[model samples]
Target: MDDRKKNKEAEKVTITPSDESTSEKGHLFGLDETIESIKDAISDFESGKILNIAIIAPSYAGKSVLVDEIVNIYSHEVTKVSFSSIITDKEEIPLSEDQSKIMIFDNCHYLYMRKIGGFEVLHAFLNMVLEQDARLCISTWNIHSWNYLGRVLDIRKYFPVQIKIPPLNSSQMKEFLLSEYEDGEILFVNDVEAEDKQIFHVVKKPLAEKATHGRIKLYTLKVNYVALRSLLMNKGTPDETAESIIIKEITRISRGNPGVAKKLWKKWLEYPIIKTSNIDKFSPSINIDVDSRFILYLILSMGYIKKCELNNIMNWKCSVDDIRINMILFELLNQELIQINDEYYSIRADKLHLVTKYLEDCRLVW
Candidate 1:
């Protein structure tokens, strides 16, 4: 393999360990390319020139994992310091030659706003990197926020080399599943392996449905692959007589969020005989601003809310016009917090659960 390919292999191995005991399968999937590019970039830094690399993508695109892997691989060769949010002057951790080697700031997108002194700590840190000329600073952020920060911070002239980590495409998703699951051969029985698509499309139907009234869909296979690997490792795979229904059900619940998938999968192992229908009991509702409640309620009610029903429900309490609801709904969709198609709006269930719960506790659920 070429040096690039070799680096990719190293990145892959670092993500999923050969020994199943210590691995979190989520790390292994959807990152080799980005990691390889980052390693190569780090190599450039080691040769004496400083480089500020940015990892930009949508939320939950695994930016943190990418940074962690790169930091781990080049721990000794470079100095690594990381941050997630805006740094206050008092909270600022100075980056010095002795303390600074390769700096990895996890969420540089948080530095856009002006605080007392305006991202004072981040400004100082970046200036330090510029003056020192020996530090390599790699940072990650949601692409939208990154764009705003880039414009505000004049990031173009400062950190010219930006690397964008695209979300997991279908092909990457399949590879991720195979690497995580033992029955990789069986799971991908047809040409369409679990990793066959960028997003794993699984139905989100309630148990009693023969034909989904209005189906909810999730990329559960990809989301929960890492969590599933961990859970399966704990319980041991089923024998010939054992069923794989639990695996499918667990994946469905995860809807492709690693954190949620892992949590739900772990809970599943504790009680393996649970039914898919019972999964609903384990789910939670999220709380968001009341202005955004109508659409959210529609989503929580299982991805399809009739316009007439929504209007009737709202008419009982508030007079939110259709235009207002439509506007806020569009905004949420843009944020990837919700998805709408064919006159139906569906909450990104993963985010909805948490946001809804918060709103309810705050008594803001509309």
Candidate 2:
């Protein structure tokens, strides 16, 4: 590893045991409709309708939370199986002979890979789901993988009841983020500089050559305003409190993703206070070749993957060797587009939106 990699490794944040506990108890901010839909599906199943459900959402958008909620509701009848990594063998899937009437599979995306002959495990799993008539099966999938498989194998037909998780709005985000804290416990500090807080700034500009001389150019002060979209959004909201402003900014930046919002909240929080100035607005520029783009898509689709897994996927899919794979991952790491935690590489929480946008633009992700 180079110095930059060493420095990045050194700067990585270590999550405490308490943080892990809090994360495991994830909040269900915008999943009421989803839960209702699941209830209706369960009711249908109870009425002799063998309708299997597929819950689809992007990574870190609370798919697991939704699964946990389902298990909680049907605690006496649901058997939950969660896959933490890619499942290459059907034997890896659990076969429960318990009395539970409903089977819930979390992270079903792991059942298949994007490479050729990768659908064997998934095909077997689907057959098992189809052949079983005694239990109602509910599975969760990454939205991108779901789309791809739906197009390729018509996978949607297998699951009649498909529920897509919705994003939380600004108000909902505020409520969810502050749920664990006392009212007014965390101070929202507005520490933006006067110039940055204003819609316009006066900048000095040099005149054209016709009005300029060597080292003596005519200078003029020009009034320049911020982006039009930003101005319009904040036009009639001058009376907004610091807390409201911070929440709105977080909602917009996170694109209403609860997982992302929580990560941002932790990043901005300084014990009992958060400052507007602490919000990160810097977007990393991504410019990589086609090979690197595909690798990035894999990382995004998997949420987090080990380097060895990346090598295996690349070698199977495109016959790319380990050395080239390492180079591409290094480039991505050097740009700070992705990060490594506990030997798993994943898109940085703060750069999730930027990375997703880039992949969407390149048609690497749906």
Best model per TM-score: 2
| lDDT of all predictions | 0.50, 0.78
Lowest lDDT 10-residue stretch of candidate 1: 1-10
Candidate 2, overall lDDT?
Answer: 0.78
Model 2, 1-366: lDDT tens digits are 121233233321122223232223347787888899999999998999989999998866888777766776676677767666677878877765545688888778878888877899899989988987889999888888898899889999899999999989999999999999999899998877454555444555555645574445555544323234456777886666779878988898888888888889999999799997887766657899999999999988887677877776766345457668888989999988899876778888778889999999999887
In candidate 1, position 91 carries an lDDT of 41
Residue 115 in candidate 2, Cα distance off native in Å: 0.7
Could you tell me every candidate's TM-score relative to the true structure? Answer: 0.47, 0.83
Instruction: Please give the lDDT score at residue 3 for candidate 2.
Output: 15
The runs of at least 3 residues in candidate 1 whose Cα sits more than 4 Å from the true structure, single-residue gaps closed, are: 1-26, 84-86, 97-100, 110-117, 184-349, 352-366
**Which residue pairs clash within candidate 2?**
none
